[model samples]
Target: MNSSASSVVDPAAPPRSNPIRIGVSACLLGREVRWDGGHKRDRFVTDGLGRFVEFVPLCPEVESGLSIPRPTLRLAGEIDDPRLVFGDSGADYTEVMRSFARARLHTLADLDLCGFILKSDSPSCGLERVRVYGKGGMALRKGRGLFAAELAARFPLLPLEEEGRLNDAKLRETFVERVFAYRRWLDFVAAGVSLARMVDFHRIHKYLLLAHSPEHYAACGRLVARGKALSRAELREQYGELFMRGMARAATRGRHTNVLQHMAGYFKKQLDAASKDELHRTLDDYSDGLVPLIVPITLIRHHVRVFGLAYLEEQVYLAPHPKELMLRNQV
Candidate 1:
């Protein structure tokens, strides 16, 4: 938002040679691996986001040597450490599933996944609110699937969501943004992290981070300022943690309005009075929830291009994910 000459303008990085990779529950991709030999294919997962990302599908039950049309599974016992068991007969398969998860996670570690989409309410792949059974067969929606839990532990910073949750526009936008951001972070690390690289990364992501958390934006700035004092490993770890956590925070309408206002400041000297009023009204409409975020973003992006605001053009906040996704249109 700061249009100061000192503001870093990162050159546009070359497009990635490899497609972004996303891990997904096999059933969500229309794989007939459910216990009943059916698939829970989500059109958005396969038809929408799938166009941009290469999916690495995994069906825990099938991959764990379970047969199709097998007995349905459920989580039972303590909420903290539930057991995967047959829904009808209560045959425990906890060890089998966990052993498979541990080994499979090691394999997934090498895949450089940007995000994961899990089947909602699945016994082995649900991201959250999966039913856990207790004594007397009482059930509570307090469990996470075994494989999902393992994946979360292995990659704490990776973006993850349930297919059901993705139906919500705001959640979907946030998830996709994080996935792309994570991919960029991966590329940054792959290219070799340095103090200078960290500064550039922080610079390009400035407005995006500010939209989510001004506090975190300032905290990250402080960390980058002291980057020379810390070891590369420490700086990378601390900065990466802060950046991802800030991204995970919900970008409320108020926060988004604040960011929009800050970005609008750059066009003050360049725009005519009528154009300024139009932009102001657009921002106000967005703030009032009368329109989606895409409206103001589109106008701001147009001004950036026409005026040749290279610094703003480089900001990831303008286009975090592919436009084809239309994530910001609804949110």
Candidate 2:
């Protein structure tokens, strides 16, 4: 559901450099792969999100040799034994599909992918809420796509999502944010960067992160501190786990904006009771789940900008990263 959370297009911005590698269904970009041989043609996915991610399109059925305009299909029976069949003609090629899924994953493994956007409800790529049944197409329980399930099982570290759900502004934004951060992690690994370097890398994100979940920001701090004694591999593995876990919390606009204000105060000499009380109200609103995490975060960011916190611009919270890594998003 690429339509789930449509991203806002920033036309005035320059093209983003060193784009994040994103795997997408061919149909989502208007490539004709549907059984009826048409496309979903998501402009937002192609143009908006496309701004920062270099999309790598995949058409499993076509790649698997299924005919275009063929019968529509759905998963039947258990998840592991999910069989894709032609609804009207009862044409079943379970073996062909299994092979296709495996082949696709092998190809995907080589790409320096940070995230994926699969076609939703497809037997091949739905990330969640997949249809399942009992022996036959009776009752359906939401599960993952056959190919998607295999890919997820194999590469548990990679981030995945569905086109259908990308329209939800919050989910779309959060997923993209995490993907960007993941790519940064991978870049660090490839460059032989150390944990201390990685620690410095994330320092710039300190206040911005607090905007989402203070618990996450605090946990990351502790995790970074623990990394002091670890090897490169250990630090990357541990930090990635902590980061992804924190990313899963789905920080709403309210929660982030509120905490952001308090964090901005971290740079200030002091905050009056009124200032503290206002921050408390924002946090209360967030804990109560009354607002989106980004809303408050946006406000907090505004304050940081207005006050001209010079150190923030220098990535002070993080260690030295690949020089370009820090500025990659700026492009």
Candidate 3:
């Protein structure tokens, strides 16, 4: 899950409760998750994302009892390939790391985590590009960290990143988008999604979905139309496949903001010129990075709830009858 986002209490952010749960490398947040008990302490992570995400700091090694200020570890074999060993002791900790990871996975299961920011180059948590050792003092291919490997195996659909990558704006946007999208999906599942519920769920996710795949968006609408013909089991399987496929597509700010602008048209007649113009300006400003897309989208959604057109709000996809389309009222 990679297109970026989130909500928390920050000066620039709208106040939010139940902030998205974000799994972080404990050391990175000054929690002393490192071998020697010193923390990484990232401000951008602590201040920037921490403002929105409920940080779940984890130190796999500490959990594994390797003690702080210990000797560094490395991948002794291959990445996604095998064997993790301690550099000095020649002690293989693969089984131990893997075992702890499994336990950690169970703990993570209940967190309703939207995403994770792993420590870079960590044997336990690096996301990508970790050094894989070949022979003595030799580095092989770059691969994922130990805990990261296990975590990815467990939650293949969850959004993840490393501190290094968050520096890039595009990556940040993708991570943000993916995490919230995951959150929305979780909300759908938690509500016991059915065909109608699924349609409603998709409606809220429409703008973000379109940013990923316009074609998929259209196809999803058709699939929703097939709800009556398909059973819940069938729909789940179908939608799950489509969801993964759509996620594989990349996201672009220009494309998203543009589609969002078109969506704003749904409210034009119902709103005054000042409100319309203001929203349009807000959308445009967000496109330029003056603010986040969430701010304007939230604004429109508020107006949408107040106004009563089903197409104007979350009802656009939730039809009256299986054959009754809410968008039919669209001007």
Candidate 1, superposed: residue stretches over 4 Å from native = 1-14
- Count backbone overlaps in model 1: 0
Question: Model 1 — TM-score against the truth?
Answer: 0.95
| Model 1 Cα lDDT, one tens digit per residue, 32-131 | 9998899999999999999889999999999999999899999999999999999899999999999999999899887889899999998799989999
In Å, residue 163's CA in model 3 sits off its true spot by 2.0
The per-model lDDT (C-alpha) reads 0.88, 0.65, 0.70
What ranking of all candidate models by lDDT puts the best one first? Answer: 1, 3, 2
Instruction: Give all TM-scores, in the order shown.
Output: 0.95, 0.76, 0.74
Estimate the lDDT of model 1.
0.88
Which pairs of residues clash in candidate 1, taking residues 3 or more apart in a chain or in different chains? none
lDDT of 3 at 315: 30
Clashes of each: 0, 32, 16
Model 2: residue 23 alpha-carbon error in angstroms: 0.7
Q: On residues 17-57, what C-alpha lDDT tens digit does candidate 2 reach at each position? A: 44578888899999988989898888668977776567898
Per-residue lDDT tens digits of candidate 3, residues 189-268?
66675988878766755765677778887788788888889988787667755764565466666766767777777767
Positional deviation of 96 in candidate 2, in angstroms? 2.7
